[model samples]
Target chain A: MSLNFCFLGAGNLATHLSKSLKEKGFNIIQVYSKTNKSAKTLADVLNSDYTTSPAKITINADVYFVALKDAVFDEVLSKINLENKLVVHCSGSLPVSVLSAYSDKTGVFYPLQTFSKQRDVDFHKIPVFVEANSEEIQNKLIQIAEKISDSVTVLESAKRKYLHIAAVFACNFVNHFYTISAEILKTKDIPFEVLQPLILETALKVQEIEPEKAQTGPAVRFDENIISDHLNEIKDLKNYAELYNSISKSIFEHHQNLK
Target chain B: MSLNFCFLGAGNLATHLSKSLKEKGFNIIQVYSKTNKSAKTLADVLNSDYTTSPAKITINADVYFVALKDAVFDEVLSKINLENKLVVHCSGSLPVSVLSAYSDKTGVFYPLQTFSKQRDVDFHKIPVFVEANSEEIQNKLIQIAEKISDSVTVLESAKRKYLHIAAVFACNFVNHFYTISAEILKTKDIPFEVLQPLILETALKVQEIEPEKAQTGPAVRFDENIISDHLNEIKDLKNYAELYNSISKSIFEHHQNLK
Candidate 1:
């Protein structure tokens, strides 16, 4: 029989994960959220019941997946009575120990990709990191994770934190550069779409070459003339200039150390 | 009839553009570089004659493409006698006027995409930015550019400079984040490939949504606990810490302004 899942949140991550699980033949039995609209919205899509209160969460499901914000994990989990039912939280930074008080069969099921409600990601391509307190639970979680994703690994909490940090640099910080690029182009009345191909290629290049080997531009070459020219052009934008200087210095120093 | 071309500085940009033009049925008649090996390497691929000496560049070709380093533009252009032939430099930051001293039909044929010799990019999708001294030259360049690229724009030198700066932020600086991400993951003995999906998706997200709206992570949310935890974890790495704080503040300020 397919293991039934009761989701404890209906945010971007929960909405996507639950929908993906449902599509993969697992039963998303119930949805729970602090807000009625979000809970109902996702539940309606999954054809599952939903409740805005954590105390009202169904105990019939074999597995409970907590997808709450990092801050409310404690408060939300405290109210639920899982009766030692298997539980997992989909968080990159948070540890499995966070769920130890709530259930003995606790694990982590972190899908290492950015999730937006509007965006539909191919879960099969996403790297899902799973960890549990016991081998039985770990295997059980991995079995389910493998069904939805082709790349599933058992990553411990100690290393998982670093993975999350690495993701911040790769995704969040990289996207910040995209935002900065758009702002710079806006000043010249140029559309952000022009930078899209360059942006996509930059990401694509690293897949083939190591990021260190793939480094280009003034900073990597330490071309002071062009670097100074760019600095002067964006000097009015204090934050961007600072970033340009700092990141350029970092790239230069990184290469220097490499030598 | 196809226009004959002579390429100067057989570097990444020159090699890719020349090969792309050759594939599109344009005749590459000659290749010139400071190093004989570099010149002959590209020349052999195109089945064209090559010369290391700038003066030895063939004047038989209707178009002379200057893809030399920014610092060597004047030194090399002074040596090559293009006379009244159309001379176009493929540079992002350099102004079109830089070629005016060399020839009356000078123009800029800047492709707004990152190029590496090892990587084969789809030229048809790459946006090519063109600029020239006259409307006639501009039209001629645009026609040639259109044959190679579907998206061709006639942008002036002033606006093109900003576009180059934007590319730096979008490609060069963004690539630095990938390097940093790899370094962070190295500490935990985690493979860089784990972050590949996240990096690619981050770039992909901007294509479907505005980067400002697509932004995620602790920085955008001002999640103090997770931010502080991450800062403490990477505090030993002074430069990474500084970048984390700086970029986080920028993201915070940016979103704050939007409200």
Candidate 2:
């Protein structure tokens, strides 16, 4: 049977998955977003119908995915029509059970990847993390997820929460670290391009080895000479200097703790 | 003129650069390290004379790259012959004038990257940041460095110091963030592979946009809901929890300073 799918949000993640699933021969029934333009734009790509309102959305599709921001998930779901359709949310941060009152077979179909409107994502490589309330829905979610990605991970809500937190640490926190580096470089009139190779290398290394094992730094070696020199170097960047010192101190303390 | 490159210390950086330079047709005249194996391994690859004793490294070279540890730069320079053999050190933290007493042709040939034996570097994009006592040595260092790398940045000592400090923030500090993510993933028994795509995308984004404009997370928006949830989620790793909170606070404060 050609399963009919309806998306309740047409954000970056929703747009991407919609396009992918459509290409895989799933019938994308309709798309919903805050604005009609966005919904129509994404629905046009999937060759599906579009709706601007949660209340206007019909219960014709077998699947409905809520792809709103995490903070508004409850408020957004409250307005949705989740009848016999298997309702789900594509959020990594929230659990699937948040849709329990709306539908008997609500679940999660979270794709663990950073989505941006600018970048083109390869859905085949992205690990699809899935979960559901019932066995039938779980199997259906897994089957649908496997159509888009080879790497399908059926995780419990608890584990998915951990993964989301880990993503906050890895992706979001790491971006802040880069912002710090770029800020310093801008002040020095040093072109930020120089940091690119090192950034790529650091990320690649972590993929292959444990971060603790891959660690290489002045702080790790307890190279006080370099740390002191570095401290003096960042003297003009008052806040940045404090950051440098605190991080080195923390890393040094972590190293000591391990020892 | 066949410039005989003599490594004053066959450390990780020294060994990697020596191999790259050797492959590029620059002669590594001698290899010297505190440990015998360190010198021997690099010397074998470089096809050069090797010695553990710095005093025995008597061969004349165009550039004597003192790739010693930061703490032992002075001690190592004292032990080695540095009358006027284009004495330079591969240290980002050390001042160019550290070798001023020993030679007029003093400079730095600091490769701005973290090198490990496991990772084979493609020198094409690696930026070689250099500083020298004289214009002639600076020019010569530039020429020599350009042979291997497409990116050669001729920076004064002040700018070089700034770049070095920025690198610590970029490479070293960014890596600590990676470790934190890995720890979070491990505690949850989630394979780090789940976060790989996210990690790659996060790093790649900065290269295309100004880091300030590219930054996204709960801290920037001051989203207390997610921040509070993350605080509770990270209750087990207290140190890391504090780290996340501390940096987020700093980042938020810094962004305010910008406005």
Candidate 3:
């Protein structure tokens, strides 16, 4: 039997997820966004009804995916009447319990990858994390997720939150380091392209070895002179200097613990 | 005319470089290391003479690449004499002046990539930073580098030092974040493979867009609540807690500056 989906937010995640699902032969009954323009844009792509109000959400869908911003999740849940429909929120940090306020068939369907509207994501490679208040809903969500992705797993709320936090550190925080590196290179008229190979290899190394075992650089080797030199170079920038100090000290201490 | 090469150290960088240059038809005439075991191993692979003592370094080579550890670079350089033969140090932090101490024909041939003995680096893609005491040797070093890598540039010592520091942040410090994330996932029985795709994409994204613009996360969005929650979750590990706070604060402040 074909399942129907209603996306509550027509943002990055919503657009990607709905399109992937629709392409996989699922019916997208409706799309809702805080703004009508976004709702219409995404709904037009999926050939689904578009709305800016939660009250106008199609009550006929098998699943209602509330893919809104984290801050507005609670407020938006209050305005919906999911009742018996399986309502899932595609948020990493939020729990499935948030959907229980509006629907008995509450669940979570968080895709464990960063999504950019400008970039097309391969659903087969993305890990869709599913969790729910009941096994029936959990199984249904898992079935739907498995259709789109090769990696589908049921992660509980507790682990999911930590996973989300880790994602922030691994994806978001790591990108900031690249930004800092780019900023540093720009000062000397060096293009960031020079560092691209190094950055790619750094991530690639972990695939073949444990990250702790794969760790390299002056800090891992405890080369205090290079550390001091790097610190001295960035001393003019207060935050970067502090960031360098703290992360280097942490790496030094982590290696010490391993020893 | 094809240049003759002498590698002053049989370490990771030396091994990869010697192999690449030799494959490119540059004759590696001699390989030297403090330990005869490593020297013999690398020399045998390159079909070159091996020695433990720097005094035994062949004077026949056109260029001598000092690829020793930073702590041992000065001591090793003191024991070698090339006179008119060009000398270069494969170090990011050290200036060309270090090589000038032993020979007037001094230069820098720093390959800005992290190498592991077990993995083969594609020399064509590696960025080789070249510098020299004289334009003649500088152009010569660039010529040698260009033979191995498609991307070669002349970068002076001052800018090179900052580039190296930025590299540490981009490659080394960022790897530490992966280590931390791996550690966190291990505690919950989640395999690090779950985060591998995200890690690769995070690095790949910057190849197309600016890192600052590609940045996404709680800190980038200034989601204080999620940031606080993540901090609270990591508070038990003193160093990780501090690292989280320091980097998160730095990212928040950096984004604010751009606004």
Candidate 4:
């Protein structure tokens, strides 16, 4: 029989995961949030029971997923009794061990993608990283993940932590660079759309070429004139200027060493 | 009468531009490169005259496009007399003044996109930033630019320089981050392909939403624990670890100030 799932949060990840799972014919038995409105909103879509209080969570559900923020994971987990049932947390950085005391079947169900409430992600393309304490649990987790995603991997906590960090660099930090670039254009009255094509192509290139081989720009070329000119342009924006100098220096040094 | 074009370089930009112009029915009269073989390769494709000598550039062509690197622009322009014909350089940072002494009618025909020999970019979607010394020259340049691309803008050299700098940040520097992330993943035997969906989606999100609003990850939320943990993961790679801390701190501070 298919295991019934209970979501312990109704934030972006929880909503996206629950909706995708529901579409795949998984039974989402309950949806829990700190606020009733948020829980009810997703529960209606999942056709599941809703609750704001942990005490109201359905113990009968075979699996429970805590998808809350990292800071609240401990406090939230402390309130729920897993009764040796399968429990997992949908966090990228958090270790699977966080749920070990509550259930022997504790594991991780991290979907490695930037989730936005407004955007509907195609889970088929998203890589779901599953981790568990035992082989049986790991196999079961991978099976469930495969239902929603074409790419699923069993990652250990140590490697998963590094993967999450690597993601922060690739996704989060890269987006911040976009934010900085947009700010630069705004000062000159140039629309952000001008940078959109370049941004898209840059990412697309990496798919075919290795990032080290694909690297370009003033930094890689060690073009001091262009770098100096760029520094002059951002002199007033001290922090951003420092960032440009630092990153450029690092890239230059990296390539210099490679040569 | 349709403008007859002469290309001064047979590199990525020259090849792409000439091909697109040729397809759009522009007469490519000549193709010049630093070497005869390189010149012949593109010239045969465009069905234009090929030459390695700048002195051999066809004077009959309406406009001459100096598409070489900025380092060679001065040297190449010095070698040839444009014969008071319309001349332009396809450089982002170089000002229109670089061509002013070369010809009475000088302008800039910078296509604002990274050009790679391996990639075929759609000029129709690429924005061509046009600038010239006079209204007549500007109008002619705009007409030629419009033949291939739907998006064309008249930007002064001053604004164009900043735009180029911004491109370096958005495209070049952003690609470097991908390099760094890929490096981190390689240490753990994780394939860079795993991060492809996240990278593409991160860029996709900014299309509809402002980047400042679209920013995600532990840094934006200021999760110091994860930040510290990431720093730990990169402890051996000093430069990358420093970059991680700096960018994360910047994003954290940027969001903190906004709040």
DockQ-better candidate, 1 vs 4: 1
Clashing pairs in 2: none
Candidate 2 structure quality by residue, lDDT tens digits, A1-259: 5899988889778988988898899999989888978988998888888888777786788998888776766666677677787998987767777788888888999988776667777899899989999889999999999999989989998888788778877877778878878777888788888988888887777777766666777888888877887777667765667777777877777677788
Better of 2 and 3 by TM-score: 3
> What DockQ does every candidate get?
0.84, 0.69, 0.81, 0.79
The TM-scores that each candidate's chain B achieves against the reference are 0.97, 0.94, 0.95, 0.95
- Model 4 residue B237 CA deviation in Å: 1.2
What is candidate 2's lDDT per residue for B129-195, written digit by digit as tens?
Answer: 8888889888999988999899998887777777777778777888777777777888978777778
Runs with alpha carbons beyond 4 Å of true place in candidate 1: none
Candidate 3 clashing pairs, residues 3+ apart or interchain: none
Query: Which of the predicted structures, 1 or 4, would earn the higher TM-score when compared with the native?
Result: 1
lDDT of 4 at A40: 89
Q: Pick by lDDT: which candidate is best?
A: 1
Worst 10 residues of 3 chain B by lDDT: B237-246
Candidate 1 docking DockQ = 0.84
Which order, best to worst by lDDT? Answer: 1, 4, 3, 2
lDDT of 4 at A149: 98
For residues B155-221, what per-residue lDDT tens digits would candidate 1 score against the true structure?
9888998998889889988888899999999999999999999999999999899999998898888
